[model samples]
Target chain A: MDATQLIHPLLALALAPLMAGIVNKTKSAFAGRNGPPVLQPYRDLWRLLHKGAVYSRTTSWILRAGPIVSLAAVVTALAMLPFGGTAAPLSFAGDLIVFAYLFGLVRFLMVAAALDTGSSFEGMGASREVTFSALAEPALLLALAALARMAGSPSLSGLLAGAVANPAVSIPVLLLAAAAVGIVLLAENARIPVDDPNTHLELTMIHEVMILDTSGPDLAFAGYAALLKQWAFAALLVGVLVPWRTGVLWADVALALAAMAAVAVGIGVVESTMARLRLVRVPQLLLAAVACAALAVVLVLR
Target chain B: MDFWVNCLVVLIAMTNLRLLGSSRVVSCVHTVAFQGVLLGVLAIVGASGGLAAHGIVLAAVNIVLKGLVFPWLLMRALRETHLRREVEPAIGFGASMLLGVLLIGICLWIGSRLPLPVGVQASPLLVPAALFTLMVGLFMIVARRKALTQVVGYLSIENGITAFGLGFALKEALLVELGILLDAFMAVFVMGIIIFHISREFDHIDAGELSALKD
Candidate 1:
């Protein structure tokens, strides 16, 4: 692959934690406090990597493999995603489905690993994750499908590239699908209005509780993978909302990166502004996303 | 201009969903008021250059009546009733939102099937959005339990009708549109008075609770 293709993956690896840092900084800024350094996540990952591992007696090979597989899946998914205006390194005609299910695989592995611990809290967390993701998955797919149809291409890169090519036709479609995918990003990443990543209460936790038993390097992997997933999804959103392409590879890549950073700030604002929906009401929010995607589909179909 | 029209349409549709999902009576009123103003702006945006004066006057009347007058009347009625929130719904919020989506889909399908008018420069989304808002208002009136919410729903229906009317402004006269607006205002005024009396007399304005006297 050329340098443009290499930039996407390298950016994913290097800047994923920076997104979490930006989010934390934004949240802290909103609360009027000096937060951790912007490089704090990187430092945390470094610390975790050097620490010793502690495994529960009931844990098996599944528990050990969970973080690695989840991270691997996310990395593979990253390879399939186009960074802003750049085509991904490994895109094919049907890679969009593969890109989406790679997350499903991550979820499956995570749930299995959580179940392997045999902890009641982790089991509850796993159940919550499965229930919510099941609702959110359709929204992601339908939104992508709408874009695919509008772009007249089934592949992720082709849809994104095609959307950017036709601004006048794509803006309305983009507005609807962007909102749908934005909600999916927040829900799937355990952000506000779905599940708060920072809440201390175990009973209310969805994602964090699932990894209660994970510590040291394993916890680090999970955290890093979560950040990468956030970046990947945010990239997808930026790709839709910011359709600007300068035709120069470096300029286009820079614009896309800036747009992705703006998305992170937007997420931070949303998290700061809205409280988590009542658990029962989470389905309603997901349904709204589905409604948005469905609307986009209907709009394009007409 | 088409972009602005679509933006307004999106805002109008959002208000429909907001009304469906909102529990607070005052917030519902505010959302409806916001929707009314959006419809006014949409009318101006949707109109062709030839009808600029008609569009502006219609939009101004819309803003005054639905945005200011109706909201003022409803809020006064709400003050008399001392009802701030609608605690019960005939259908739950989540279900109402889902139903709202279904209504929108059906309306959009119908709208797409209908031919666009010969001379109108309106966005194709206008008709479907108008129909969706209309159905959502009707849905609210049916599904909400409070008398105040019903009033809000009725006002939403008026807003929807106004939006629908905008799509036909080329064929319909300015006088007919004004007459419709005045009629809507009077209906909301009458509804507000009746709601105030019901809440004052019965001490609770729950429409569902009013069915006890059917026998």
Candidate 2:
């Protein structure tokens, strides 16, 4: 691969933390308060990395391995994502399946680490995370499948590129898939109407609860990985929503970055305006996403 | 013309799905009203000429009665009765939706097999769309417990039949079609009045409770 193919992944890693900051600032703006700077997440990650590591007495080797493995999985997934019609460094047939399960691997590792801590609170978080993610997985896969059918490509790069390549045949199908993936992005990232990431209470948390015990560099790794995953999903959404491909590398890259920011603002608006769904209702929301995807598949087939 | 008809068909299907999934009574009313409006458009579109005078009259009556008059009457009844919630259904939303999909599949299979009158200019999807909407309307009436929702279901069934009529009955005698429309209007108007009285007496509008009438 040429050095230019490296740009998308590198940009994703460097800019991931900024998404958290944008969401925070947007939430703060809606609440009529001066929020942390847009660079606050990056600053926080830096601070965490400088601190020494901490380990629990009851934990085994898995505890130490969780953050690294999860982050590594996210990075691997990022390698296949095409930002704004630009192909990834690694593109292959059936890479979409690998892309999905890499995040699943991240969740599995996180849940395993949380369970290893032997705390009831962490276990509760793990259970909620697993249940919700299991429901969300079908939405993600079905949406991808619909896009694959529309584009006639089973791989991530090809699918994203193929989606924009022909707008006439794909617009309706793309619309349905975009909505489904949008819900998946919110649910997978622990956003509002799924699970509130910033809830002050531990009793109602899903993702934050799982990482409560980790500290220092490992915490930094976990935090960064979460942000990168958000960026990756947001990129997928942007590719679907904004299908403009100017052919020039810089224009496409710039448009992709701009679309990513727009998506962040959109998420913030959603978080501000809507109350989180009741725990029982989250499955219904995911089911709605599945229905959208399923309907898209039906339309494409018809 | 074909594209517009397909769009209308899709819009009709979506409203049926929303009606099946919606728990709130107001939104269900809105969905039924929207279906009514679409039926008016379909009537005009199904006309053989540029604008058949009879089709124009039918469209106007449908838009007025189904879209405006019935919803207004229902909302006024809702306000006076103060029975707004329909949170629980005899059949849950998810199961209803699955059954809706199955019903549509059945409609499509049956619609394709049934012979259509020769020289009809309408899309092939007309039969399936009409049958699907009809089944969903019946499903709503049978599955929902609230009297208002059942009435909405009844209106939905009327909308389905009107849709079917747009395809088959438009070529026949206009008096027969006009009578059908008048009958539906009168039935809903009476149902609205009865719903108000029932709510005033029983303090709830659950149709299941009407079984107590046998004693």
Candidate 3:
């Protein structure tokens, strides 16, 4: 077993929550408040794991299984991602489809879990999540398709690794793809300008309201899964924006780690600068992203 | 030089689509002006010689007219009208964007198939970008509801013609190129005057409603 192969997964598992911590700390700095420590996410996860879970009699087994299954899907998806110079643990031809669909599965379970709670608010969140994600999915797939065409590779590993090697593709295409993926990253992770993760107001919330029924280890799993999902998407974003390979494993890994941290801070900057978009206007923003990615696609295809 | 030309071409195409997808009239105006400036810069970059005298002159005039002067003139015309967006369009934003994409694809195909003129300095992507811009401009003119937006569309069409002139046509005749610029200046001035009349005659500037009037 190569040491490099283990680097991506281990780093993701250990540092996922740290991303959340960094994001909060950045936001707090922007807001002029001394926020929680950078390790707060880890502490929260630990506390949640230690507490006992309490479920209402009204819920079914789906509620219990939702977080675990979603976490499982995220882990599998993470394994398929190549970070910096470290190759993915499991990458095959057309693994991009599996990577994309595993998130779909996670979404399916999360929505199902939300619906199972019988809370109208969770249902609302579920619907909003589905609607926005439905708009966002084409942009994601189309952007990936653009990358696939440029690289002429169907899998995530080959696509990210070899896409830029093609002299035919230019910086504009990559910049546009990066922009599309950045928007999708923000949208999928329930960040600002799409959905606000920190809002407690039930009417405006999307991701948080859905998880209102979760507690204890289940909540911890969901939170951890979220962090991993963030890490995975951040990895994908880094892969698109920065594909620098030094041929030295440690150097490349360090660069990837730095890129991941930069993505967190970037997210924080975005959240601080822009207000959450109106629900009705969110599709327009996503459509603009689609236009951007589609332009890149056209450029690549041409 | 090639990368800069390619980026400019791509950016011009993007600005055309931005005009299509945008809702607000002012932003659309800004977008077309931005496209105009890009077209000017594209002309300068697409020129073979390094900052030739005519190239500098053409770029300066093009940028001044399209970027600064046209925007100021349009904003002056737009100030009297309370309208800020294209609220009721024949085509919605999403449909317009998709159509713009389809237009680019078709134009790219057509552009690749068409032969580039012999010994002319033009990027392979330039002709298609010009075609795409032209098509989007025409679409905007027809589909948009407001008069100000239609004017933006018209300027976009002229920008397309200007791009084509810089790339595929008028390699020698700076006179003809200047004539084209002067023609657009007059056309915009005339159109602005007409828009003023139309807005004064009617309470709202929705051009589609004008079809109801009979001479």
lDDT of 3 by residue, A1-302 (tens): 67788889999999999999999999999999999999999999999999999998999999999999999999999999988888899989989889988999999999999999999999999999999989888888888888888878899988888345644356778878888899889999999999998899999999999899999999999989989998998999899898768888888889989999999999999999999988987887888788888888988877
Model 1, which residues run further than 4 Å from truth? Answer: A162-169, B115-118
Give a tens-digit lDDT track for model 1, residues B1-215: 77777778877987888888877888898999999999888877788665578788999999988899989998998888887565468999878888887888899889889887687655788889988988888888898888888888888888888888887887455788899888988999898888887787778888876777655
Model 2: docking quality category: acceptable
Task: Supply the global lDDT for candidate 3.
Answer: 0.88
True contacts kept of each: 0.21, 0.00, 0.42
Cα error, residue B6 of model 2, in Å, equals 4.9
What is the clash count of model 1? 0
DockQ of each: 0.50, 0.26, 0.50
DockQ of 3: 0.50
lDDT of 2 by residue, B123-175 (tens): 66677778888988899889998889999899888888888878874546467
Docking class of 3: medium
Per-residue error at B36 for model 3, in Å?
A: 2.0
lDDT of the structure predicted as candidate 2: 0.85
TM-score of 3: 0.94
Off by over 4 Å in 2: A163-169, B1-12, B34-69, B107-130, B159-184
* Model 2 chain B lDDT-worst window of ten: B168-177
What ranking emerges by lDDT with the best candidate at the front? Answer: 3, 1, 2
What are the lDDT scores of the predictions, listed in order? 0.87, 0.85, 0.88
Error of 3 at A284 (Å): 2.5
